[model samples]
Target: MKMCRTAAIAAICMCGSVFAQEQDRKFEVYGFADLNITKYWMEDNAAFRGLRYDDKLRVDLSHVNTYFDFRPNGNTRAMVELSFQGDPVANRSTAGTTVYTVSQGGAVNTVIGTLPLPAAGETKVSETQGTTLEGNSKIRALEGIVYDWGSFSIERAWMEVQFNDKANLLAGKFITPAGVWNVDHGSPVILTVKQPFQTGLVSIFPKSQIGIMERGRGYIGDVDLDYSAYLSTGRIHNTDETRNSLLIETPKDLAVGGNLSVNFPVASGLKIGASGFSGMQKQEYRQRIVKVDITKPATDAANEAAGLVATGKLDPTGIASYIQTKVGEYVATQALNPDNHSYDDVMKAQARENVFGVDAVLDVKKFSLQTEFNQQRIKNQLKNDSLTKTTGFYGLASYKIPMGENARLTPYVMYERVMQEGADNNAGTFMSGSNTGTPGSVLEGFQTYVGGVNLRLFTNFIIKAEYSYADVLTQGIYKDHETVFDAGALNIQFSMAF
Candidate 1:
């Protein structure tokens, strides 16, 4: 009887331990998805047509995201988000080519042949006469389409430690604490189907960073104040004509930035904020051979010298001198070709940038107003390069109307502008070549007007329809000549969170 009573007590203790553990840990899962259909129209300009989205109706399975939140205890929390995004209308194809070289008795012969097209995600390689040729394929849209295949990415993963209501610490990959639009990044939460030109077209600031941040909030005389400071890996210097992933590149220096905001209780949801970042952006331009041509000047020179010697027109001692001169000329010609160089010929471009912005938001009952202004100054560290300046501003207003129970309608309009000066407007300075101006030249700026309406059927579901018109100032051949192009787009989106 005594042993039975001991077993019962132990069983009770085990149950208590299990309950305590459950109370100490917590987990939750949620996600959001969006679908978009868009129609675009632009002036028929050959220079800009290929670079911009085609003028057609396009449907996209825009974003499918899943989020996980966990709390091991009251003071610490973790969050992770996974996103799958791209257009379903996109497709890809691959083609291959092979080049053969044959050298016999100092006479070289070349032949070009076509190989069977490989399937997607496959590479074809052929080797003949001690020469190797490889055919590589990439993912791209079908002919006349400007869409790409779907991609899976980890959007955010971060952990936070709370020390009190006044102070907290967060670290990992997190979104930048910038203007109002960037923070409300989710499609379900954003009021409009289209984002501001600053955030969408030319990103003055990064979307997120891997680093550490310190944030806190406090009350000051019935006014709420929040502030954050962070240090991150920032941007890397990649001049390979292709963008490099931040996860793979090693940063030369760290970036520092901060945000501060104040909310006034008297104004009823009025908030003002300032955010800025300063960092050095660096890039190294490396020359690489994209193709090998066996019939270069050097080969021609060698062949000529051999023929002269066989014909007894050139002496053995004079042949070296003649060949040396020819080789020097060949070197100069190769240098003119940007691709025929080694790592020792790399060029570097480094610049320091300081970006600052101010944002304001006013919410009164069912009416809301938001505006932001951002400016960036880039000072080139290289000699003979001038300072470049870019500025962007946007203002948005919206009014919400009741549409029966569990439904609401919000109509909104926005105007945004982006301008750049003190440098040539090219692909390197702007997000895209076609959107800015002609290469190695300057143009005015771009301005956009947007109008949209949102229908919220439930707290977690929304439908949006939007129209936008944009004008770009492009430069002509003459210094004083400029032209403007009008472009427009219509977008419809459905978003849901669960």
Candidate 2:
């Protein structure tokens, strides 16, 4: 009887110990919180176009992320990370039309030369407003609002399960695997204060995809191959839910893509990868319309032709007929008038929006270098004949100077350039939300230079400051279409992760 009691007690003690160990493995909590401040020194009235730092400086909570981890064992784990950041869309607008210069050099209210004006009650579409005035003006309006600065939102919420050291599966909203900047996009961790424009605006990087991800890694002949494949609800299609092209609503469609990378075992510092995604981001394209009188010109030209025929300056059978034809041709050539001067929402098929990119990351000792080149093809609905291709690239280099054992200062410099081929000149929309109707509002491309430093006060606290210069390239609508404009700013941030 004593032996039985002793054995029972021992078994109960073992079970209790196992339960305690399991409890310890079931829960883990971690996250990061950060503060950021941005100041604009873009000289008075500098045309930043779509970047929102028009003429002010602002400060807000940059990131507050919390992570809850559930691990049942070494081989199985799940995670949930929530981002609490400021609202990215406090500046959005559903009203007010974005107006653009119809004249060359973005000139307003002044006609340059003998630009003809349509007569009274006639609506004309000109480089200038078609009013019977000195300046003929043309205007195009898009239906949407720009993203406002400063608001709070849930940045990421996803669950990940690891099958083993070499394989894993992730479900829910997750970071895109397009580039290094996106994969390691915490403000406290990156070398710089701001992301590259190309990565943020054009590439599949910097956008969250709601989907499932499968990741695997293995060694091949002294080299390592790491890959991630994902299927997600594609990009948001409604402009009303878009803030700077980032969809703010739940996705309802399928977007499939993946990333494959190779890391060398020779050195722990180098990795090269490529990623691509194809999906429909279709939205209703609202074509700009202006009312114009279509009947008067045809009538006046016919009357003139009849008079010419009667005067015999043109023979009714020969020269008169030719004159009438020429008159009709002239009117048709200048016909800016449409049968219906009302606006129409043509459901434009951004039927196929695809992005492909290659990226390389080098972390050799204390020095790190990152670069990526991407090409995005978006089919143009308005100009159905062509597919708009946007190409962009960025290179960033940084060096870390360790201060004692717990702190370090890392200085970095980066350059980025973007070119949009065959984009609408009047689509003065930008991801940065700066110039509403000015320079970049209708910009084509730009070159940017950014330099910054990150100072770690301790293992958990970091201070970062950066200065950036932007050389804006105007679109075809401006006389200085290819000309370069200047914009510059300073950014400072403080952050902690634990």
Candidate 3:
């Protein structure tokens, strides 16, 4: 027993020595954040646009890096970062759900607070149900930290093992490196409000599934190549639930997908690259209601009346050939259930075809030509709806005109077309609410032609001005619309590494 106690004391001494040694290590820090305020003149009832949409301002107050990046001996080091932001503005609409003329008209869902929808657009829809998670229309503060071990996966829980040259295992809630937008770090001044077509909107990562990603730099003979294979359980966040997009977000929901890219160095000062992704993404959604005029066929209306009489008025049970059972009555009675309100009581299967994206950049002297394109096949289980196989694409070309020594001016033109969903259903509005039937105030798909010029002075301050015109896509009578909006800004940033 005496010998055992002595050994235990020795072990404790070793632990104390190790702790003392760790106290000798050191850490490094860097990164910056700023604040920006903006005011826009958007059309009244115009489909709502956001920071990355038309012209919006972005702000950042705090972002720092603190990590013990220097190792004592081994080729190993540890690093961590805590990012922060103190700016937030809601992009929600004034129109949610409204009880239109409740003097005993059509079926009444419930009597909650009423919000008036626009007269020109479809009636407002209510956000009845869906998954719930803390979200940010604009980043407030990022309390997340990043850790790196042995330099495997540079970020997140994924690791870049040394066994393979250009292979990595990516997991955790990490951002997808899909486009040129600087989402790895969020700053509109650095990242264009209108990201390239290949990259998704500001809030969306191309693919941020909580799964594994195997990516690395490799080669196809002398051509030289880089590829990534990813499998994840995730879905794109449904920002506008009232829209006709296929939404199936739920817990236990998984999305498995992958992306591949190949880069070819044609010659000195000349290189080209391409990449794509495919996967199964599903989201379970609640009911989406817009103020839709139900012009039932004479026979259909007669059948509804008969069912109403048979089932009693309080629970009028009607059945259309397409809409089976008494769905309206069932939901009207149970729409507010904590866990029971949904288009389908059970989790429905909705899938979005992995997007096929490609971009090309040509290097010429100090200037470059960059063009990006993407095609999304929004696959839905239920067909015959006009919203099948919708697509969107944008193409822009700019020339960096060098002026004198410390300044450059870039003037560019772009053409973008976003196909509207449910095209056949006139007055078919994309509601932002669930089952409330109110149209979301924002519309994205339109033939928006943009022309802009950006001027940079002393490589620090940049001023970008753009003018856009569009024909809003909707059943509304407004057409051939034209509006002009622009922005001018000044910035200062500096970063040093040790």
In lDDT terms, which candidate is top? Answer: 1
lDDT by residue for model 1 over 133-186, one digit each (tens)?
112111111111133467676677999999998888999988888878777778
lDDT of predicted model 2: 0.61
Q: What TM-score would candidate 2 get against the native?
A: 0.65
What does the lDDT come to for candidate 3?
Answer: 0.40
The alpha-carbon lDDT assigned to residue 110 of candidate 2 equals 22
TM-score on alpha carbons, each prediction: 0.70, 0.65, 0.53
For 103-172, candidate 3 gives per-residue lDDT tens digits of 2233343332333333454422233222111120110100111222112112222323333667555444
**What TM-score number comes out for model 3?**
0.53
Task: List candidate 3 stretches off by more than 4 Å.
Answer: 1-29, 32-39, 49-159, 162-164, 182-193, 196-207, 220-222, 236-253, 267-274, 279-349, 382-387, 401-409, 421-444, 451-471, 474-477, 480-498
Worst 10 residues of 1 by lDDT: 136-145
lDDT per model, in order? 0.64, 0.61, 0.40
Over the stretch 1-498, how does candidate 2's per-residue lDDT look in tens digits? 969944743453343221244335576566666777887666555666444455467787766666666777776666666665553534444343333324434444321122233355443222112322122234333333566545554455666778875779888877788767777767666778778876554443437777788998888887888888888766642244232233323453367888889987544478899988876564444443543221212354564555533442433343323322432343345445455244455443333567889999888888888899887776543344345567788999999899888989999999999877755422222332222232223557788999999999887688999999888776555555332257777889888765
User: Cα lDDT for residue 401, model 1?
Assistant: 100
Top-TM-score candidate index: 1
